[model samples]
Target: MVWKLPLHESGHPENELTAESDGAVIRRTVLPGGVRVVSEQLPGQRSASIGAWVNVGSRDEQSGHFGSTHFLEHLLFKGTKRRSAMDIAEAFDAVGGEANAVTGKENTCYYARVLDTDLPMAVDVISDMITSATIDPAELETERGVILEELAMNDDDPGDVVHEQFSAAVLKGHDLGRPIGGTPDTINAVPREAVWEHYQEHYQPETLVFTAAGNIDHDVLCADISQALKVGGWDLTPGVAPRARRDTTPIVGLGQESVEMTIHRSVEQANVIIGSTGITATDDRRFQLSVLTAILGGGMSSRMFQEIRERRGLAYSTYCFGSSHVGTGTFGLYAGCTPARIDEVTELMVGELEKMADSGITPAELERTIGQLSGSLVLGLEDSGSRMNRLGRAELVTGELYSVDESLKRIREVTAQEVQVLAQELASRPRSIVRVGPFGS
Candidate 1:
């Protein structure tokens, strides 16, 4: 069983709680100014991973500000009031640690992995970056060119471009459909003021989650974070409720019709994705859907790999994936094959989908997929970085926390019938196809 620490809301300067189960101790401390710090101490681990999770992403941007979130992600690393980009780099390098950040559809995370003894420095540096970024106009202009190069790079990859088209086709007219990196035009047009305004509005103490995992003391780390933020003039007031969760329900008005889009590129290989709308992140069927996806195309032993690569040698790569957001999701089967074989590949992929929907997976497939899913889940959490990510995402995104054992048990409890039901439900949805290849092939 997973035990969650009881939270204290008594307006204390540093209200703390701890929960222990399965040999893992999870701790939480509500600091002044409504900052929430959560940590998990892993025994005998020499490294610590920490992340400052901000509850904003591309989906939160308005129409004209398409790439503001991602652009800001880059700008934050450019310089802070206390440290230049070079200083920040040297700080991490001195500790033999790595620092990075990522912007997703719904959140942005700035994280670092460092020796356990350097946990304090990691917290200080990351907190400083978040709370004190200069967002200099000169820096913004430089980063703008960098981001345009990034967009150009994406344009050069047919596989990446096809997935973008697939998203636009299926989730048309919604912010979720737009690329996380704004288009070149939008990126160029967005004024520096707009991004700064976004940063100010979203980067609040209450909207951030600070999480660390490894051999560390939660109380000391919390104090370090508080001190760091205080250096940037953050008001550490206690007793305020954290910001309410953002509503992530995308505006969906496109009719549920099968949409097919083709992007004519000069690439030698055709990249294709056959996909459909899927359940939300909060849906109960997600576990079963995961199992279903695994059996269909998760590994060399998966059905798609065996049928497409092993038997026919039609493609070197083929797989199925499911992506869930706060209120919407997608399931897709992707293949990269010679343009000459695009039609055959699509036919076979779609046929497999129809078969799974109608007949369901066999008992052996179900057991094997469950085992694969279980093993993958266990193996993924073996490091402090993974554990830190799990903690931050759970606190910021899902709002539900579970221990490793608890998560594995849930995956193990998925029944064959449940997977079959989910498979049929997902397969029955109208599929949208996007292909990128030479025009006449």
Candidate 2:
């Protein structure tokens, strides 16, 4: 935000992964209970965001309790030892701030964004919910109806329905392949203790991180976070696998629901999911894969949108993204196009990847892609929420905080030769695909 914002925070290993423009002071501290803290100072902004990201998500669900993580997320909003769900909402609403939480494949995060004056209060309310969450049976039953409604909502959307099926198909057996939200039946069947025990096991200090970004005094943050971390009286258990990780058959997890909504009355838009075996959060070559994603589908001027939309007008939208967890990652491409163009679209998406694998990207494409990515990185920090996510996710995956300059350096170092080697090896490698359309599949 100022001239000092340009200097990168040095000495943190994870910074190389997330920061883009080094404009803040990044600090890391380890507290009792194995909890990690990442605090970043963003000068000249009035808003701040604090996020508590736990290192477990839907994939961590045990059999018969398939959607435990997501279910648990809902129950947290019901109430906690220190506050009712409504009371929690009112506190933030009184100040016009926002509070929310989400469950993902490898982690669960609860965050609040508020004016800098409210950071301390925001921290307490959020910390209370995560460490002191109490799930009442009556509340879980009520939440069941809410979850079922969510499932119904997903069923009504063709795109969501197919992606859910894709997750089911891809991980066939791995937690990574499962939906973050469990099935209605599984959600109903889970007992209170099962969900409670999960928190005990997964929400350990070592596996959790408290992150804050924007408009806060650094010394105050250190003290406030230290106090927030101290409020939770629960003892964290060590050495337990957060949840049993299961392996499933590798397959193209595809599903179809045709004719239910009057097949011919609707224009045909097939949803496609192409994914492959994972990479690690700490992998050095991740930037290469990121560059490949941009060149292929990042913008209207990029490869997919340019060739598919600008040049030939073969489809409406196409894009590719690569994601990595602590132990696994995926490079996936998604597209929506008319049924008549499905085969051609799929072919083009796969073909470009193959071409890039065989013949590396041109020098111009590499330069543009690298530059675009660097710019995007710097822009993301403008939002306190984005900055918090950057820090929270960084602590979860690599256990370090980075300065923005450190992150941009890594992107700048991504080379055409590096991307080609990585892309070629990955594209040639097997990928599980899922498609939902009118043509028998």
TM-score of each: 0.95, 0.85
* C-alpha positional error of residue 421 in candidate 2 after TM-score superposition, expressed in Å: 1.0
Encode model 2's per-residue lDDT on 283-397: one tens digit a residue: 7677777888899778876777877777778777788877665566666667888877767787888887888888989999988888898899888777888888987665555
* Model 1: residues with Cα > 4 Å off, grouped in runs: 2-17, 248-255
**lDDT (Cα atoms) of all candidates against the true structure:** 0.85, 0.71
Pairs with backbone N, CA or C atoms under 3 Å apart (clashes), candidate 1: 33-236, 33-237
Best of the candidates, lDDT: 1
Q: Report residue 117 deviation for candidate 1 (angstroms).
A: 0.9
Q: Which stretches of candidate 2 lie over 4 Å from their true place?
A: 1-21, 226-232, 235-267
